[model samples]
Target chain A: GAGVSQSPRYKVAKRGQDVALRCDPISGHVSLFWYQQALGQGPEFLTYFQNEAQLDKSGLPSDRFFAERPEGSVSTLKIQRTQQEDSAVYLCASSLSFTGGPLEQYFGPGTRLTVT
Target chain B: QQPVQSPQAVILREGEDAVINCSSSKALYSVHWYRQKHGEAPVFLMILLKGGEQKGHDKISASFNEKKQQSSLYLTASQLSCSGTYFCGTEMDSSYKLIFGSGTRLLVRP
Candidate 1:
């Protein structure tokens, strides 16, 4: 795809189940970011990756949340023991660079995860 | 703190104008504007880096006031295609993370 691509556009998982969301950012983009958006709310930062390195994970809601980008191309966000509160739209975005104060970020369609 | 967007929603007639404002309680580094339709990803519209600088696309323009920690988006001579939810994303000190506002839904009536 020409733009950012995400897998499993919609997922419904039972409580205590595990789920993984995948994101394929724009090719050659160096910066990737994950955000979680609850119903009727704006997206909140969850993690950030600069190339293959996980620069920051401070925004992860809990230990159950994990993300990895092994080769600076595709990234995955895994959530274990899902809870009702875990339901939200997971969004992935990528920018051309990270050093500048602000870079235009291209966003994916986002994966809607519903934990029931 | 999350930026506050005023006029939670607005309704406009074709060829009209609308203004959406976003304000932050804390200092800000930059402001980004994006528009999202009913069920799609937010698309980048414009970015304001310097205070008092205004950038425009067609009839859409935006201004940033560094001292007030606020930014406003102006849509002049609006068209039907302009109807959508507008969100203001802010960054502090150029942090990698962008905090987006709740959003303001705009409805354009023909």
Candidate 2:
């Protein structure tokens, strides 16, 4: 009955370091999403997963961003060789339906990644 | 493309009403609204579908004008609890992914 959960609530990484963020969606949730929130701005979509297969990833900023949902429940978003611009809050969300009116998402507290 | 939200920020007193608007250049299939307080997760507020179906609590309702590619979230008799940054996520296609707007910051004081 827990909502979406992300590990490493806070992270400090040096520029050019690689960081991996984890997300555990609600039990049996079919849809999962990743977003990046910069200071004073809204969240920007990074990627989406339906079960273990990632259907859309066009929102990923660059090649440094990679995500996988191997088991269809737990997902990991890896940022390779991070940059100072990568400093932001990474939020994970889950929803019940894939499309239409009930597309409400349940979000986690988010992992704040500070790149120095 | 990302949607656009108006009134970058607003300050209101308790019991007042506020409206947040989201407009998109592309034809939208649905619009979703959410609220996020400082240092907190974004909570779902409501969803407006293409064909006139709307979902939300009575106090917080949203309307979608399909023809104009716009949606408005109306918060009547606002409460301090309503103080937060409001975001509108737009779905242009059948995919579940949402392209979120820049967001509208709303502050309510007692």
Candidate 3:
């Protein structure tokens, strides 16, 4: 693909329902990141991946939030028992490398998740 | 932690200039600027490394001060196309994750 891609541009889930958002990073991108953005707010980092390894997830608000990048190419963010507060735009970004330098990040359109 | 962005919002007339500031509590290794228009993802603007360097993209320029943990985005001769939300992402010395600020919304009127 030309750029980072995310599935289900918009998703509406009832409270308590589980929803999964998929992200396909740029091919061969070594770093993948997931962020949550509430209305009128900036995107907040949720998790990061270096290849197939999950490096940091301290930003996950609660145990209900989970993310995985088993194949290192595609990632999925699953929310269990979604609450109305969970309604936000989930953004996915990928960088070519994670070294401590100026790494350009390409972002996806983002999935607007709405929990009723 | 969320970086502090000053002047939550600003309205500018075409050909005018505006400055958006971002400051972080933690020591910053780098500061990244991004602009997002309505219904779109954030577009990368520029990145300032640890050193005191200024990078410019067209009329948009940014300066980072590693010591003060501060950075400012400078919009010269602002245009209507520059109307959007600007964000500053900070990478602290302690972590590799990029934490973004609340954002500054800019509206350019003709």
Number of the predicted model whose DockQ against the real structure is largest: 1
Q: Whole-model lDDT for model 3 versus the true structure?
A: 0.92
Candidate 1 — which residues are off by over 4 angstroms? Answer: none
TM-score attained by model 2: 0.96
True contacts kept of 1: 0.68
- Residues B1-110 of candidate 3 have per-residue lDDT tens digits of 68999889999999999999999888788898999898788999998887889999799999998888899999999999999999999987625588899999999999
lDDT of each: 0.92, 0.91, 0.92
Q: lDDT tens string, model 1, B1-110?
A: 89999889999999999999999998888899999886688899999985678899898999999889999999999999999999999988777678899999999999
lDDT score for residue B30 of model 2:
85
| RMSD of candidate 1 to true structure, Å | 1.1
Tens digit per residue, CA lDDT, model 2, B1-110: 88999988999999999989999999998898999999999998877888765556868988898888999999999999889999999988778778899899999999
Give me the runs in candidate 3 sitting further than 4 Å from their true place: none
Query: For model 3, which pairs clash?
Result: none
TM-score of chain B of each: 0.97, 0.95, 0.95
| Clash pairs detected, candidate 1 | none
Error of 3 at A106 (Å): 1.3
Candidate 2 global CA lDDT score: 0.91
- Model 2 alpha-carbon drift over 4 Å, by segment: A99-102, B54-56
